[model samples]
Target: MPDTSSRIARPRLIEIIAALATGGLLTLMVLSNSMMAAHTTPLFSSLTAHGVGSVVAGIALWGVWLLRRGQAEPIAKRHIPLWAYLGGISGALTVIITSSTANSALALTGTLALGLAGQVVLALIFDVFGAMGIERRLPRKNDLIALAAIIAGTILIIFARGAS
Candidate 1:
């Protein structure tokens, strides 16, 4: 087998841009969710967000279906485990937690920084364990270093905000 440890795939320019854009969108989403939570409640906020998202997704899917009416082959249905549906629960929890934290001393920046750190740690665990059918791979030295740096930054931001 090839030495894949040192052969990390470099992200393309477009991929990098897309990632940045997604980050921006996430920040906006968190902000909006938190605001809704502030006025109403976390549960209400999550419900509203998901309801809107479902409608938008349904419309988009309908448009795609109309555009590709007979051009696309029928997709084969695969068995999806019931556990896969847990993502909706996880998403609701995320909104609740972030909404609560963002309204607290953590604020938006601290919330996002800590959230990023959590994501890095979970991603490492998922990669190592091949969770949810993800490819199993040992984290590279650089990955650990990056994780450490992100954690350190998150801690600093959280503490700095608290100190002010």
Candidate 2:
């Protein structure tokens, strides 16, 4: 029989790509926010950056959607939930908060540490609650352990002033 492993591997490959893209985005945010803050106030910089970025990203996504229109399933805007559309509001707030907080005594690493810690906790809450159409997944002992480790590490990083 012919091997059909490629189909089985496709999801994992897509997950890997998504992870890489997310990581890249986080890194870019760190660098850009830091640099932008240098020229003006953090809040102002963040607003400008996010405004420009949103426009560029919107255009890029639209272009990509247009190009791939025939190859993939058409997305139904009506089927998307109202909650899903509100994510941009949260994202805009994130840019403001993260930019204003980062590099303001906390520094990049410390800011990122605390941010990641908060993100994990919130994500766990969302997962457990099955919020926003996600499937419910209760946290286990291992999840607690991981969260503890992450919190501990973040605390350590925040306090370790001499290391940076």
Candidate 3:
């Protein structure tokens, strides 16, 4: 039956987590930029550390969320989305380190490789959800569009960063 009941609930949850993740990253970016502009070394360093720390902490937090939610609601044919979030953190770290080493060809190539790898991981989540036929029931035109845009933006980020 594709769990008609879950279509509403699961989408809501997926939207919520995605929003929170996006908002958290945006807020961190803004705060970090503001602090750097103000020349507040300690605050900038602390905020940067906090942002990185939050991602590491998210691995545990999301695993718990998945465990709790999966008991009643299974999305993407028993595949867990929490792992994707962890990969995202690792991907960002790879990009940061590589971008910093712009002179090194290995670093530049590695940055693109990591970013694409993370996107593929995310795509796998969507693909599984699709194969499960959950998305078919949702009819989420707006959500799909947003997903496409985000993926495109991510690709652009990888390209732009690589060239810089």
TM-score of each: 0.74, 0.64, 0.34
Using lDDT as the measure, the top candidate is 1
Clash pairs (backbone) in predicted model 3: none
Q: Give stretches of model 1 more than 4 Å off.
A: 1-8, 74-78, 97-118
Model 3 lDDT per residue over 1-164, tens place: 54444243235778889988997997787576556635754344545666777898999899899879847664455555666547556645643554455436556546555656766676657554664333623435676687678767876876787678
lDDT of 1 at 14: 100
- Residue 75 local lDDT, model 1: 82
Kindly list the per-residue Cα lDDT of model 1 for residues 124-148, writing each as its tens digit.
7777767785456776787678668
Q: Candidate 2, residues 84-161: lDDT per residue as tens digits?
A: 878878877886677657648976666777787789878878766677655566666765786688578757866785
Root-mean-square deviation of each candidate, in angstroms? 4.0, 6.8, 9.4
True lDDT of residue 16, candidate 3: 85
TM-score of 1: 0.74
CA shift of 65, model 2, Å: 2.8
What order do candidates take by TM-score, descending?
Answer: 1, 2, 3
Count clashing residue pairs per candidate.
0, 0, 0
Off by over 4 Å in 3: 1-113, 122-145
